[model samples]
Target: MSIEKFIQDGVTGWMSAHGEHSDIVMSTRIRLARNLTGYRFPIAFTEDDAMAVDRAASGVLLDTNQPNYSYMKMSEIPSLERLVLIEKHLISPHLANPERHGAVLLSEDETVSVMVNEEDHIRIQCIYPGLQLEDAYKKADEVDNLLESELPYAFDESFGYMTSCPSNTGTGMRASVMMHLPALTITKQIERIIPAISRLGIVVRGSYGEGSDAPGNVYQVSNQTTLGKTEQEILVDLGNITSRLIAHERQSRELLIAKSRLALENRLFRSLGTIAYARLLPNGEAARCLSDVRLGIDLGIIQDVDMSILNELMIFMQPGFLQQYAGTELSQEERDVFRAKLFRERLNIANAPASLEEDREE
Candidate 1:
């Protein structure tokens, strides 16, 4: 799909479902890392080798008669368009990295996508909204099996799947949940809670995944160790811990309301006022504020705004997405102004009562 259609539809990937506890548990993702039987890893592949892998992947996708499963050359796409895909989690950071000769085969439903010649020969992923690890894995496995019949994968009898990284050698699966834990973050409990969770072999990463900061108090929690454990065992462990974190976050939200309702309301309303009326908005500031507004919606503090609108705003406000919409490169100042205008229009905060603004200031 074209970038404009992708954005206009707003019904792609993990963004589609409103799952259980969706207010807190944003989405779940399962990724499988695989390599071709004879080909070297993407990093070591010559130009010819990369093209060969790409062609082979395209052929396999052509053979699979699944309706609406389309393929595209990622390198041929414009830069901003790739960023839009990244923002939507339709493609990974590695796949979006510049000058990479790779292609992606994705279903029209946006639930499953496979990147050819990324970090591995093939990187397959499946995404579903909220906490659904078992379901996500099942879907990914089915796709992987279908692809296996078309192409042979590199494997070792004792080690299982062979991957570029030692950790992913066996199983080669990563199960992650995208979580919005504003309550825990605001309460400063995340300082302690995150570490304890890390100790349990779970890796906490940012919204865009590895090596990124949490922009909106949003975190991707996934299993750190995948080699020895069976895929089912890994899923259960992650599901249990994620469930606990969800419980803790809910408890923190209740405590915030019971102990300091006025303070919490004031914070939420003030954030709303700034996002709706601010003349200049930085990316980071907007993300943090949007997190507050999202929590407000969940807690019944804000009623007019739809959750889908806020969710779309979360990605739309990112710098690259902003530039793409602007149809040109933007300086930081220009982006700030563009972001503010977009937020004000989408949120319709301009028509809000003047008295609410006064109260927000108070």
Candidate 2:
């Protein structure tokens, strides 16, 4: 699909807000880091080497004869369009780098993307709505098998799949689940949970993964080490941890309702009011407000808004998506204005007051 079509269609598939634990779990992603045999890793690649790798990987994907598959080189795509791809999680920040020579092959549904000449020779990624780690891994493995059939992979009998990073040398898989833990964060339980999980070979990262901040109280929890575990083992371990997190978050939510129901309601309604009526919304403030509003919806404190709209807003509120949707480049201040307007329109807050009153009466 063309980037224009992708932007116009908005969020779908994994970002559609449907699946198990959709209230807490935003999505699950499985990424496999791989390198082709007989080539230097991407870090050492010259322009010629990078081009060759891209050609080989993109060629394999194109030759698959799947009508839904679309491939675009980073250089050929506009910088804004590239940023949109990153916002949608169709491509990574690294692949969108101007200095990097790479291309991305995407499925029409936007669930699967294979990045060529990224940190590794091939980075196969599959994302599913909510907590579907096993399903995501199944799809990713299918793509991996198809690519391995056409191109040689750097694999060792003892070490499993070979990757550019030694940490990913074993199964080359990174399984992650994105969760919105407003209750945990608000109650200050996340501070205790992060270190506890880290001890269990699990790491917590911001929404967009490593080195990014977690806006909207969203966090990405993933397995930290892949060197000693099988892919199935990694998935199982992460799944167990994710289930526990969901339980903890739900418990925390219930605790908030029991201990400070009025205060919680006030906070959520105030957030809803801010997003629905404010004329200017900064990205960070927008995220926090939306996060509270989402919590309200999940807890039956708000009923007028759909969860899917909130999910889409999580992406749309970003600078890249806001600019793309407006069909123009925006300064930081301009983006804030456009973002507020977008939120009001999407929320359709005309009946929100009645909905809020009705919810409170219950």
Candidate 3:
């Protein structure tokens, strides 16, 4: 159950699953930020203090014995392995920094991960496939409660929990959903709705969370203001907005399929062709193409493909994931070539219907 074994096992994490509603809702994640009562934030800590915090947090996670969780030091894990963990959403962006003395306790199912000595003293995260905010929150809350008994968290009566970020002060809870909104993006509606959603206190970012572009029509939407609201309120508000976005995406899909069926089909099949035949495919291009093909499968435009494979590819196609899968470092050009070959093998290009192109011609 070590991080090495977890990586070697080729686990896809929670996002790889086709959950309750896998079509548009890719995955839902709940993150809780907490700090130790006596310790300063990570930036102020000496190396020894950081290591001490790592060990203390690891001890608490191990003592819990709640399920299949394994603790490992970040220093021991390789850079590529750490990247793979980030790709799987099992660790935070800040924790990926090798200079930091930190450890992560990861659940076997990859749904739960507790980061020790990251931005805050601890970051407990629970991720589930599809739109299951309530369920995700429940799991996260269970872990938070378990740790509360053993760890003295920094809390104030006026404000609920103290965190490094001002926006996360009160509840310290961020409930977010990774949405596949290709239809919205395709119809140019996402641009309009994103600002509107932001005005409602919801923050929208690219697939990798803050400071990343939405490369595959994938966006992570979450609440920006967490201070005044309770966990339930955050979830309720996010859930309502997410449900509306899902409706809009579906409606856009139906409209495109009806109004421009030929163009939509052309785009889907062209993507499939590129995946199957291209000699070189960049990660960004692959992601965008895969998103379209996945949407096609969901809409029944393509029936022979497996949604599970596509779900898995969404993780496997990342740079770190591909490098780990290859067992070595690769240059940009090398990765592109390898990616194309890998995609063809996974897609089974030999049997992919050649008629897809013919249909476009007709």
Judge candidate 3 against the unseen true structure and give its global Cα lDDT, from 0 to 1.
0.85
Error of 1 at 109 (Å): 2.4
Q: Which RMSD values do the candidates have, in order?
A: 4.7, 5.3, 5.2
> Which of candidates 1 and 3 reaches a greater TM-score?
3
Given candidate 2, what's the lDDT at residue 216? 96
Best by lDDT: 2
lDDT of 1 by residue, 1-362 (tens): 54456544444656643887788888999999998877778878887888888887778766746656667777677887877778888888889865778878877788888988889988999999878888899999998987788888998888989888888888999999999999999989999988898999998889878899998999999999778899999999999999999999999999999999999999999998889998789998999899999999989998898887888888888777777776678899988988887788778665634332342233
Write the residue-wise lDDT of candidate 3 on 277-297 in tens digits: 888899999999999999899
For residue 6, what is the lDDT in candidate 1? Answer: 57
Rank list by TM-score: 2, 3, 1
Q: Candidates' lDDT values, in order?
A: 0.84, 0.89, 0.85
Using Cα atoms with residue i matched to residue i, what is each candidate's TM-score against the true structure? 0.93, 0.95, 0.94
lDDT per residue for candidate 2 within 1-362, as digits (tens), equals 67677766777687788889999999999999999888889989888888888888888788747546788889988898899889999899999986788889888888989999889999999999999988999999999998899898999999988888888889999999999999999999999999999999999999899999899999999999898899999999999999999999999999999999999999999999999988789999999999999999999999978899999988889888877777778889978877777787788866433332232234
Clash count of each predicted structure: 0, 0, 0
- Which segments of candidate 2 are over 4 A away from where they belong? 350-362
> What pairs collide in candidate 3?
none
